[model samples]
Target: MSTRGKNHSEWDSISTLYHTVVGQLTIPIAAGLVDWVHETVPLNGPGANAMDNGCGTGIVCSLLKSNYPTLPVLATDFSSAMIDEVLRNAEESGWKHFQARVLDSRNLDSVETESVTHLFTTFMICLAPDPDQIVSEMHRVLQQNGILGLAVWARPNFGFFEAAWIEACHELDPTYEAPTLMDPEWIEPENVRRGLAKAGFKSVEIKAEQQSWDWENVNAVSTYFFDGHNPGNTKWHDSWTERGQSIDKVRPLFERKLEEAYGQSDGSLKGPVPFCLAIARK
Candidate 1:
């Protein structure tokens, strides 16, 4: 399958569970990034129009609308279910002057050239089919001197549970290889800055920070990844199946390793995930 197709399928499968699972953990980080943008960028200027490209569960959208009540906001995602969640949350929050649409971030055809005043994408570029193309699209839609803010996972490592599962996969089948989820270069700050500059963005700035999450126990962490519901773990299981391997065979090993590395005296786990934040001007 093409990258776009695979991403859409994976994200669609997890849309319903995103808010209760991932969103519950990432929303605060999203809010903090939005707060940084609000402080650094002039968001309340007249004729300001903003976009949340690849707005997964609308955490950034909610923050944008709440912080800048009158700013017109457009939130787009490739998954219909994700857009549905955004709309549902918007209605519940009585948020006005906001629009949610199902659109590919790589090619934003609905938005006109040089129209948007600000663009924000949290945890979106890392999953984009073409990170460079997505950056170009953001540059295309932004007005002259418009601000662009983005958050992407840092490279060379996975989340705590993700690492545990990967280690188990390797131990179970010594020759097994992991799938490449996205372009590796996009995870590096220097590469991202270069891509933005090539896309016609200026004043690029990137910062790396660590974000931590706490889980009730190793079981909760394991359930979040291997319970046959998580899109990420679904891919892992499918890969194993294709290779004539059984993830079930490795489940116990994975759980034991996770408990040994992350388990606390109280049986809880706290995992730190790193992210890169970038800001630039069009």
Candidate 2:
């Protein structure tokens, strides 16, 4: 299978579980992009419209519905299951003027050239098998002076949570090594600038920002581990499976380490995910 095909299958298999697994990422991360869009060009402004490119579960669409209910919005993702979730959320939330399609970000052939007024992609850059292609596609789909809002996860994110995963894996198997989440260069603002500039975007601004989430308690955080739903947990499970190690072997250790990492005095778990927030003009 091609890279896009593999990603479609991987994300589709977990689509029903994805919304829950994203924890707070779906909203808080996308909120920064949406907020910036409002500052750049109000969704209700004359001739204004938006597209949540790679709209995982349509978090940005939900925010747009809340803040600018009448804005014509297009939500697209490679995973049809995710697009289905977007539609489900739309109907349940009484959204109007919303449309969604199964579209690959790398080649947005269906979206007309220089059409979208605002494009928002959250937490997707570094992970894209072809980030440059996606960036160029966003540039192509945007009207002149269109705003491209992007949010990408930076290094050392997930707080001590990642460290805890590593420690647990090592305890289970002495020589275990974790996969690199994504290329580190994409996390840097300079590289982001270069990529966007190469994609025909100028007048770009990028900032380092953070979004945080608090779980009920250590037990809840540990439970999030068992499902291995999120990428970190998925990696943790994959590492063990490849090593012939049972997930149960890592549970108690991961929980204890997790409490030590994210455990708050108030019996809650919290962490900061630092990200690169950028707004570019076409």
Candidate 3:
């Protein structure tokens, strides 16, 4: 088990703040992955359906609805709060023939074998405690020749922000130690390919590249991260608070560190975060 404890549980508390955290980066890529699925997979037809196994707040479902209004979409996430968000979206969007489930991607016991025509999981499998099992479950659920579109970070894309935050934490309390956001080997394309092959994916294609993102200014970027209740952000807050330090006191220092490294001419933050999208077939 990860020493960070159950990250999934942390995700539950930040369901509302999730969109503000990584939605800007993941949603566009999700759109692209959905479009990519459309090239081969039928969105709507008899026995034709799609599932977003690790759907966070149903970004993929919302996009799928826009593309195929009548498509049978199943949005599943480990967090009930996230499933609730999907349900809320369905209610507001008037989605038809859609379903949402609070299910872990690792063990999709509720999903049946050869059930979905396409499985799309953006920025999900990488964080899985057992990606091989997650991929195995995905393979089991997908119909013959079904495609898996998996998006993950090429590596943690925190830029200079993490180091600066750690610096501030150390200054506040010398006992501070930064956490590892991800495993190094898991991000390797070769390892991903090997894992997929083990999961019975015969044809696997992996692409690693930088995806550009924008911000009005660096403060906008900082505000989204610092001025939020995301688990990732909350940990820092908890650390700062437990150390008997006002969180506000460290903001200026962190801001200066960010501005020095990432600030643009117009005071905007940097862009073009790295990510990998693996398209595999069973």
Q: Which candidate, 2 or 3, has the higher TM-score?
A: 2
lDDT of 3 by residue, 1-282 (tens): 001112356678668877766777778888877776676565665677888888888888899988898888888888777887778878888999888877778888888999888888887776657777888899999988888888777665234357678776677677866665655545668877887888898788887766766767767767866876666567667767876888788887777776776768976777567777777888
Q: What 10-residue stretch in candidate 1 is worst by lDDT?
A: 1-10
Error of 3 at 272 (Å): 2.5
Candidate 1 per-residue lDDT over residues 119-223, each given as its tens digit? 999887876678888888899999998899888887543465667777888887878877755567788889888888999999988888878878788777777
Candidates by lDDT, descending order: 1, 2, 3
Q: What is the lDDT of candidate 3?
A: 0.75
Q: Where does candidate 1 stray beyond 4 Å?
A: 1-8
Query: TM-scores for all candidates?
Result: 0.92, 0.90, 0.85
**Candidate 1's TM-score:** 0.92
Per-residue CA lDDT of model 2 for 1-282, tens digit only, reads 011222353567567766775736557767867887788777789999999998888788888989998888999888877888888888888888888888889998889999999899987777767888889899999999889999887773345467887798788688988777665657788888888899899898989877776788888777666764666557657867898887877888988887887788998888776778899999
Q: How far is candidate 2 from the true structure (C-alpha RMSD, Å)?
A: 3.6
Q: How many angstroms is residue 249 displaced in model 3 relative to the true structure, after the best TM-score fit?
A: 4.5
lDDT agreement of model 2 with the native: 0.79
Instruction: Give the number of the best model, judged by TM-score.
Output: 1
Q: Clashing residue pairs, candidate 2?
A: none
